[model samples]
Target: MYKVIRKILFLLPPEEAHYVSLFLLQLICSTPFTRKLLRNFFEPVKVSPITIAGIHFRNPVGLAAGFDKNALHLRELSCLGFGHVEIGTVTPQPQRGNERPRLFRLPADNALINRMGFNNDGVVTIAKRLKYWREEVQPYVDLEKPLIIGGNIGKNKSTSNEEAWRDYEFCFERLHPWVDYFVVNVSSPNTPGLRALQDRSFLEKILTGLQKKNQEMKNPKPIFLKIAPDLEWIQVDEVIELVLAIGLDGLVVSNTTIRRDALLTPPNTVSRMGAGGLSGAPLKERNTSLLAYIHKKTNGKIPLIASGGIFTATDATEKFKAGASLVQVWTGFVYEGPAIAKNISAASPV
Candidate 1:
């Protein structure tokens, strides 16, 4: 059914097709009868819940960060059965991201290349939306388990690296009350100089500041660092050292990669897609290896939420075997249709 629908969607630009499909789903979900019908067909079978970082996830499958940039579709997305939905990469201030055609599809590689530049409705606005969901919508949702929400935060493009910690701190404070957990995203390739925040000196300042603030609160949220897959082993070691030093909650094993090697997509075709992070099947091996490396290095002390290349039960099972406590899907959700979370959760060992 999705294959046929996908063919028609494929005719439109990737970003256009994204909103159009979600809009349709939003309409379908607006009513009780249709929403229940949608849930009946798409929700995963009930499974034992798992605890990670002191939070309960009904299942291991979650929708990754970039899917719902703002907190706009939580009600509709919750009906699709993801155990958690990560929103943002939100900045302290809203900004229009890079130019159009920034998001591209690599069908041959079952991949997507996006240079979205952390575009979002900013922290304050999104925090308000989350507050409403927690106060109004969440209590009424009928489901076997509660849906967890994660805030994925980042700095604005105009913010200098020296002052970046302020941006992260601002978002951390505003969103702390509303989200279940927080992912500090410093690895997106699209934003200029953003990846530099991953450096030990810069990263330590930002993370330490956030942690200090977190401790001041009565109930602190779990905070995780999201890293790029392209990092060298030495860089990974630095990240591990910092995570241990700060007692950070966990790690979102990867963001997307800047490297485009070993792709089934033709060189000319991929080159046309230009400079954006590459995600999907090409990312599985390296991300899985990173998960194993970090799990071993930390002696399994640091929790891992695997992202990149997970499209099926086999892919998700590979993540669990590699030491991921939870898994997130972005490209997989786009390529696999609405049943992705249900399908993966139904078969996941975790």
Candidate 2:
């Protein structure tokens, strides 16, 4: 069924098809009856609930960040049976991001390449929408428990690296009240010099600053670092050092990769779509290996959320065996449709 729908959607431009699909989904899920029906479609057989970073999740399969940049579709998406929905790589202020044709489909590779830069509705606007969900919509849905929502935050593109901590700080403080957890997004390949924040000094400054502020709150949210898959083993070790030093909650094992190695897609075709993060099937091995390495390096002390290239229950089971406590999907969700979560959950071991 999804193959047919995807074939039709593929005829449209990638980004256009994305909005059209989401808009249609939003409309369909607007009604209580429709939402309920959609929710049960391919709903997973029960999987035991697990707690991660002090939050309860019905299952480990979650929609990754960037799929719902504005936090507008959590209610609708949650109904699709994801254990959680992470919203945004949202910035402190709104920005248009990279120019059009920024998103491309590599059907041959079963992947997507995007230079979307962190295009989003900004933290302030997003917070207002989340407030409504928490205050009004969630109770009405009346699920067994509140759906987990992680706020994935980043600095505005215009912000220089020197002052980037302020931008992360701004979003962190603003979203602290609305989200169940936070993910600092410094790994996006589209954002200029953004990955520099992964440096030890810069990371220490931003994470420690957020942690200090978190301590002041009546209730602080769990914060995780989203790193790029392109990092070296030495760089990853630095990340491990920082995670332990700051007592950070966990790590989202990876974002997308800037590398384009070993793809089934034609080189000329991929070169034509140049300079964006590549994500999907090609990412599975690197991401899973990184997950296992991190887990082993940290001696499984740091909780981890696996992201990148998870397209099936088997892929997810591999991540679990690699030491991921939770997992998220972006390209898989795009390629496999809403049932990706339910299918993976049903196949998950209790």
Candidate 3:
């Protein structure tokens, strides 16, 4: 079972275990024989199909952005039965990100804290990979439905707030033809002063620029804003207002939170782990509350993609009840293993 494999993986360092797991999965998925066997074991489950932001999803469960930052594992991950897979918080240029020991696991709280700082291959390289997928690889998968891909983008750490729009625009333009949708990420806590761009004036500027560029495309992709859970109601309201005013497609109802209150993980241990956004079970209450609030405020008119703390069918159902049209998983996927998407999709409400 996954618990046994997880125990072995847990013995390794968090970040190391991640790459090892992905590498193995990538290898398994590379060959059609292994890929078919894996897909049979973890078959896709179609629950209530829904269309959000003009894209049709075979199911509501999706892989959250941070899991596959460079679009490397889309073929394999899709076999695990996610309706969508979002890649990147990709910048215009590749980044080294923060120092090592940046990712920590809190088994007691079922949470992870990461100051990864948008570490990823830059837009150009990632776009090339995607181009191959579209032209060469996609024809082979032959699924019943197409997997929706979301491009989650942000600025490089060295980029200033004033010049941030250029970075976002660069990514938006480059990824436009390849990705099914786009998420503007100005909410990550790891990047210094990045969250400042979430302010109404600055957000308007960045989003409007992306939207303008998006319109120039013969087929403009759906654009969504990924917001932090730390924002106050007033701030969230302002975001809703901007979303409506700009005619943006939707919102991803949170990134990870910087707050670390009430965790079962001891204070000393948590302090040792240090600064980064905390995600997983500890995030459930706050994440769902924010979902409900956003749903209520927007009168359930604006589509929402719920992230944070979803680990089970019940969790996905809770998000649906709270007004999320789609749900994404990152920490849960780490904990629950590859069967998660299939399991959650099977258990989802009719």
Give the Cα lDDT of each candidate.
0.93, 0.91, 0.92
lDDT per residue for candidate 3 within 1-350, as digits (tens), equals 99999999999999999999999888888888988899888875557788988899988899998899999988988878888999998999999899999999999999999999999999999999999988888777944677889999999999999999999999999999899999999889999999999998789899998998889889999999999999988999999999999999999988999999999999999999999999999999899999999999879989999999999999999998999999999999989999998888888773
Which residues of candidate 1, in runs, are more than 4 Å off?
142-144
What is candidate 3's CA lDDT for residue 74? 87
Superposing all C-alpha atoms, what RMSD in Å does each candidate have to the true structure?
1.0, 0.9, 1.0
Pairs of residues at least 3 apart in sequence or in different chains that clash in candidate 3: none
How would you order the candidates by lDDT, starting with the best? Answer: 1, 3, 2
In candidate 2, what are the lDDT values of residues 1-350, reduced to their tens digit? 99999989999999999999999999998888998898778456777678998999988889999999999888878888888889999899998889999999998898999999889988899999999989989988845766899999999999998899999999988888899999999999999999999999999999999999998899989999999999999999999999999999999989999999999888999999989999999999999999999999888999999998999989999999999999899998888987888889988763
Show model 2 residue runs off by greater than 4 Å: none
State the local distance difference test value for candidate 1.
Answer: 0.93
TM-score of 3: 0.98
Winner on lDDT (2 vs 3)? 3
lDDT of 2 at 119: 90
Q: Across residues 1-350, which tens digit of lDDT does each residue of candidate 1 receive?
A: 98989999999999999999999988989888888888888888955579999999988899999999998888888899888999998899998999999999999999999998888998989999999988998888854578999999999999999999999999999999999999999999999999999999999999999999999999999999999999999999999999999999999979999999999899999999899999999999999999999998888999999999999999999999989999999999889999998999899886
Backbone clashes in each candidate structure, one number apiece? 0, 0, 0
Model 2: lDDT to the true structure? 0.91
